[model samples]
Target chain A: DVKVTQSSRYLVKRTGEKVFLECVQDMDHENMFWYRQDPGLGLRLIYFSYDVKMKEKGDIPEGYSVSREKKERFSLILESASTNQTSMYLCASSFYGETYEQYFGPGTRLTVT
Target chain B: ELKVEQNPLFLSMQEGKNYTIYCNYSTTSDRLYWYRQDPGKSLESLFVLLSNGAVKQEGRLMASLDTKARLSTLHITAAVHDLSATYFCAVSVAGNQFYFGTGTSLTVIP
Candidate 1:
């Protein structure tokens, strides 16, 4: 089975601290995505990478950035963590043409204090 | 912009009951996806509807899509304790990005 792994399952950060969430896929998928899931808003995409070193902003990308240094690893960066950024972060990976079926990581629940 | 909306943000049903979750999108899309996520867990893919009038079923759950109307429905035939989870419908646009619905939280009581 295809597997997507996140570096951390739970994290706590101080308000103004820089944070990083990493994701790696074993399937070598071309597309990688970062999303923040909230209670009422569901999952809102923060950023997505279609290829190495390529990134695009999704619907809600205000406080987040992403890096795709290699084909299998994608990282989400929080420039400065804030209280509003506390949410469950999900990472997903899929093949180049197949966007309908994405394999998701276990998710990282970040708490900004 | 693509917008996906799901109806009945919260649903509670008794065992052996039947219900359906509705998903609607704003624009035409090539495919629609259904996913289930338990509390504090990642999402699990359920079904992928590719064309209009496409229907896919697994066990007691059935998903159908109508591309013309940009709507999809996930119908649960019989409620069970293990089937309780949040269901989300997503639409794929421009080949690489997907827009997810707000999600429906389903709870089944015995």
Candidate 2:
């Protein structure tokens, strides 16, 4: 069984605060992703890391960035949070190549006040 | 650029009813996946359709894919309350990135 754990399940932050959400996977997956899910919008990818120190932007990467200093951990950073950034953040990881069936973490519910 | 769209964004049906949720993508891809997400929880992978004409089923849910049509269908048989959740279909592009749909939120009434 694969386990993906997030640093925080629920977080509250004020506007313009720098927020950090961390994810760690035990399966040693090479690909890690960050997505923010909103009502009606579903899951929009923020950023993804294919390997240590490698990252790429996804459909909705504005106001967000990512860090992958190690293989087992991936971090999502909101340089400056806003009220509109309040949503559920999901982290997922998968093996390299074609079989991209992801394993997701419990998710972080961030509330930007 | 790839786009994924799901039909009937909100579905409300009876417990014994049968329904199908459609997922359409705007690109050519052979690998597609179906996932279910309960409220306040993360998504769980349901099926992975890897080829055209591929069909997979578990319990009362069946997922089929058509690569040529760039479409996938998740059918629910005799739906139950336990099956109520947001269903999303994603297409694997370039053997790496996955583009997910807006999701279909299902509500099963008793």
- DockQ of all candidate complexes: 0.76, 0.81
TM-score of each: 0.98, 0.97
lDDT per residue (tens digit) for residues B1-110 in model 1: 77899998999999899999999999989699999999999999999888899999999899999998888999999889899999999998886788899999999999
Which of the CAPRI classes, incorrect, acceptable, medium or high, describes model 2? high
Q: What is the interface RMSD of candidate 1, in Å?
A: 1.3
Candidate 1 wrong stretches, greater than 4 Å: none
Error of 2 at B56 (Å): 0.1
Q: What CAPRI-style quality would you assign to candidate 1?
A: medium
What DockQ does candidate 2 score?
Answer: 0.81
